[model samples]
Target: MVLSSSLSHLALLVSLSANNVLAAPRPSSPMSLSMNLKRRVPEARSADDISAWAANNKLALEAKYGNTKSIAKRSSGQNLIVNQKADSSFFGSLAVGTPPVAYDVILDTGSADLWLASSDCADSACDGVPTFKASDSSTFQNKSTEFSITYGSGAAAGSLGEDVVQMAGFSVSNQIFGVCDQVTDNLLNSPVSGLLGLAFQTIASSGASPLWQTLASSNAWDQPLMAFQLTRYNNDSKATDLEPGGTFTMGATNTSLYTGDIDYNDIPDNDESYWLQTVSSITSQANSISISSGSSALAAIDTGTTLIGGPADAVAEIYSNIPDAEAGTGQLEGYYIYPCSTTVNVTMAFGGKSWAISNADFQAEQLNSNTCMGAFFSLETGSNAPAWIVGDTFLKNVYSVFRYNPASVGFAQLSSEALAMNGVNGASTPSATIGSAAATVSATAGTRDANSAVALFHSSPSTTGPIISLLAITMTMFISLRLV
Candidate 1:
């Protein structure tokens, strides 16, 4: 089913225990506490952990994503790898997990809900795809509700069951999550177990209960929204072979996250689906670039994106910036291709200044000793599928933070200093083509204090809470732990 953003108010029923809240299950044993209660958040985790995890773990990357800084970092992705023993969260952080199954999740950031696809699905797509057998989990119970979730490129079909779900860094006892009976079609059937929708901010379906409202009104986390820093991925490598992307932080930054200037864009009370934004500017490809990490290119970005759309001509143009570049390849779609050995300096202009792609991002997945690929590319094919998705490929290059501001709407971009301080790492995932040089943004460097990250919490009287950074958003607030 094409999950409509409006389905929440239709039939969803979010019943909370504390009495004054939004939505699910009880913790398994005495050791597990509902995330709705309280738990200790990590304060000293490091990039070193991320590097070890990504390189060593099968599906994990060395990068960890988080909004917390006092200690560590991890590569947070938009999906999950569910296991029978996977921890669940219903309220607080006491029920978090360890190793690969910890609560740190890569969420849709754009959608809401803190659901896990349980293992009860009776479909073939469930074969290799990870599943959470609630019956065997010992902490499982049926909510008597059937459920299904959809994404631009994927979908999870299952039943709405109750269990203790692991969260941010702990657990949420008696949480409500999707127990999939049908396997997620598409590439998700291979590795990704399920999706953690971070958009809606609530576990919505028939009722308009966003994950954010449930948490905030429930007084769960200190904040509602989770912070992210996708170090960047090299699609040049196989998709299934994803690396530790970045750090999903919560509450703080590391010795590295400098305190910088922040710009916030407020979300309207009536509509959250419309990530509401004015046209920042039109790309050279004639595409309007609103620039949102939370908003997937496929769903929110394109007006004429019959297929995945992007800064069309800008892609070819940027590839040319790399010295001694080549033309393009693959679908003959004009995407820039290059050798992994090349050190390309790339930048994105926004506020009159350019954000640089760190050297790490510029590097390709290193296919063999001679071949490499570029990070940026147009997902458009001659097909009708909305194959579009503006992922870390471009975001990692800029300080593309999304937050709310008073008197403003939706989200806001970063300040000149906030962005200038963030530097580019490696060359863009190797590209197959090189077009023209065109114009570039000024490259004046700036720095922000480590403690000054753009915080997304709630305000009073506004019905929002302090953890999420706004009027109580939803779950999908996952941060992976890595050894970067």
Candidate 2:
């Protein structure tokens, strides 16, 4: 599914447990906790819609920040390869509560707040998914705090609770998260049960301490850093399979994941919302045009979003460079559609490094027999939207590191192993037209992030706990259309 914004709610649950939380997960050697992420795409929603949704988020951020310039830098520990679906969102599993009930959650970097379906939730939104039964846990505690968090795309209302949450082998005890009794239907239909936000705490909707902060406070990790290794396969074959695709590691950067030096850039502390950055230029090799003008403009590094987005003028200039490219049809206006055979090279300059987006990344999805949607889309009204919203479309091609100490974001070239898996290392291409070609590449080259945040933890067979099957939320709404 096309996961959207972050929102959370607190609810009362009657559960009992000791305040004694697990210090951290302990492994024999240097170990990384990993989870396989799955992807879901709405059959009714076209790729155009997905790209436009990302653009909408850019506009929403503009509305929230106005002209403000504030941002911060920030982990290393464990690693796990995650799975991703073609043209959609990525998800993985984490165990929560005393017994460690497993829940599937969509990891998001665009917003702050961790929420899941409440066991007491009688609403239709919680139907058929995993729920946290507070009564069943020995460590569950009610915060008595009520919250109503609204997002650009969706909302959740409930109360707060404290419990032990585990991702892979990493564990955080007495951790607080939203127990949502009410949520939007789009989120309900999503394969995930809840959402976990990775953005700064200043933007947390529930006014609660963020989960990453909790883990960072503990001396479990070597450093306050996190890395993602998203693997996009050649087709939809891995979409339903619980197979390993990539890795998400915490505490330490896996030297095996990327090649060359990991370049970093500071996120101006003033831009404290998303991991926002200023881009010097955007280049399209097809036309040899430097579309970026004016001073460096802001861009958000969002993992929750599936497509790349920017101002209409900039997006248009990008499409103009491609042969037989045109605006999307009807309600999909503003989105670009191009011949499936389109080949283009686009690069964005940031932190003094020019990161090139492979041609494969631009061929978003096949619309029909002849047309395919481009990953780059135009924000509805660019006057307020950030100059760019860099989503998974581009991030998947690079190894990304979000550092907290200096409050900066970094990117490095994907290793040979990553390039081969993502179809960037000169993977074989079919000779058929855009339709057959896209289907071939989309199946193999779809990019997904294995976002890992690992902390050390020691567990006995008895204390290992059960895996909770809770569902995570996918915020489909970026912002209210009225804001657009």
Task: Quantify all predictions' global Cα lDDT against the true fold.
Answer: 0.30, 0.53
Deviation from truth (RMSD, Å), model 2: 13.0
What are the per-residue Cα lDDT tens digits for candidate 1 across 1-484? 0111221111110001000010011112211101111111112212233222112211111000100111122111111111100001111111211111322222444344444445565565455544455544554667677676543333456667655443332223445666666643331322234445444432254233433333333323332333334332222222112222333332222213223433334443334442333223324222333443422222221110011123455456555566555654332233444666666665543223334555455442233354344545443322221223233334444333332112122112334433432222222111111111111111011111233122222211211111211111212222321111
TM per candidate comes to: 0.48, 0.73
Best by lDDT: 2
Listed per model in order, the count of residue pairs whose N, CA or C atoms clash below 3 Å is 161, 82
How many backbone overlaps does candidate 1 show? 161
Shift in Å, residue 436, candidate 2: 48
Off by over 4 Å in 2: 1-30, 33-77, 189-191, 217-219, 234-243, 286-296, 380-387, 423-484
